[model samples]
Target: MMLRIPLNLGLLLLLCAGGATALAPAEATGAPCGGLWARCLESKCCATPELTCYEKDHRYAQCRPTGNCRPGFHHEDPVQTPWSCVVLTSPAPAPGPGPAPPPAAPAPPAPAPAPAPAPAPGPAPAPAPPPPPQQCVDKGQHCVDWAMAGECEKNAAYMHEFCMKSCNLCGNLFTNSEEGTAAAPAAAGDGSSNHAAGSSNAIDSSLRGGR
Candidate 1:
């Protein structure tokens, strides 16, 4: 069983227990209390004697000087804690007891976390093929025509390397003998361009066209 106490009686008992007066009811009726400068023990009331109960803490309070206290001085004003200044009179007997409080309700469980989403679908990129090697070959009859017509000026980067004999870019590939100069251009040019679809014409005719 639990001990239940009424608010007013509880307050009177609390005040009396702290060093204040004994009669909460009489104090409520505005009765005069002990002389000024007296501790608020039996006479909970301080009357109008220019004094109030100077409370030190929750468990201590006494009648201290009031009005006429010099302003701006900390010690002048005696009232301390914001707790009640008026102590109660006699204690009121409380009822025996009541049923013990019901057992506390248990707390609810926490919620579960949400699941993460799956990754997006797709194929990964493939690696790039390597570049072909640079080889010397005029490529075709067009190299000579392109050189003569100044196609070398418009497409100099390609024309200069491949058409070196006809465009006169690289020094002579064959000896300066008349036969070497005469025979080299036609043979090398015809043998290679069809050998590869790319710029270098690096592959041999045997592998490309089964010649």
Candidate 2:
């Protein structure tokens, strides 16, 4: 039995180089092909073999370079990286943006330490200096008269020590070592000579009276 079917000119079957009729393949534009860095599906197919497909996760995947370059980077096609690949940044999402951070709080000022105190008056004046001590002076006013009357020769111990200025022994107070040695011996010798001379004069006077 022969099954009859009407043929349309536009839907005609394709012919092969072998002179035989064959079924035609589906059109290329029938299913969409991804471009470079374009979103992809589980099939992971791309428009060109240089641009391969990769699945980032179950929900996210994209078409990227088949070279060593990973995500978050890029490279030049015909220049420096003609054969190799660098990192390729992923495509952005279609959703809205996220929220921002909170604002910072203000700080307080620091205070000053110890307050200024009142200063005291200046220091007290220094004390006055004491009066200078008296210089060396003779003890008695009769010192000069006694020294001149030759009392120093008779009483050398007292005169030389007490009447130092009159005895010409000033600054040698209370001392009679040298002056006494000279005066004492000479006074005793002179007194003996005067006694002898007076005795002779008395004898002469007595003899004249007898005559």
Candidate 3:
């Protein structure tokens, strides 16, 4: 029988040979490296070691330990890990738009007009004064007799003289005298002989008989 080493040892030898082959530096082909083992470093594809990878179109390359692969990159090693990369960039503008215009201000309300002043009241009417006393011409130039007694007597006397002077105009002098005579008798008392006798008696009593 031919002598046979264990199949596991043979497989290990084959794997070590494959690893050596994979680690060998290759000429840059400028061709896209395909499959999970590929990564782009500095715009080129480089055969990375197990679990090491880098971002595409980046300036730098990164190498990680075994079982650490970049995120979003497939790996045949069954390792899930996080990767950091440069974010895309955009240029800042020269001058930004100016600040928005301020909102319009509300208009102020109009002031109320002043009320008109009330009119002033008119002046009160003046009280009327009492009339002056009547004057008598005959009394004096300035004399005004309020009692009128002297004025009345003078008026009666003047009327009498006026009637006497114009007797023809007056016409009833006899009738006036007759009324006066009747009034005198009533004043004197009828024929009092007692009064005359009393007077004689007084005279006789006053005298003594002649010798």
Clash pairs of candidate 3? Answer: none
Question: Which regions of candidate 3 fall more than 4 Å away from where they truly are?
Answer: 1-103, 120-123, 128-131, 134-211
lDDT of 3 by residue, 83-180 (tens): 45332211122366899999989888888999989988888888788788433223333122211223324565653343322221133432347555
Roughly what TM-score does model 1 have, to 2 decimal places? Answer: 0.20
- Model 3 / residue 92 / CA error / Å: 5.5
Candidate 3 to truth, TM: 0.19
Q: Candidate 1: how large is its RMSD?
A: 27.4
Tens-digit per-residue lDDT, 1-211, candidate 1 = 1344577778888877865455555664664465566555534656554555554445555565653222233444365334444333322233557999999998887777777778887787776777774455687778876765566678888887778667554444536566665455555555555443554454554468875
Deviation from truth (RMSD, Å), model 2:
15.0
Stretches of candidate 2 off by over 4 Å are 1-90, 93-107, 115-126, 133-211
Candidate 2: how many backbone clashes?
5
lDDT of 2 by residue, 104-188 (tens): 7766667777787878878989888888844445678888668656777799998877776666664355345776645644665
lDDT of 2 at 123: 92
RMSD (Cα, Å) of model 3: 19.5
Return the TM-score for each candidate structure: 0.20, 0.22, 0.19
By TM-score, the better pick of 2 and 3 is 2
Greater lDDT among 1 and 2 belongs to 2
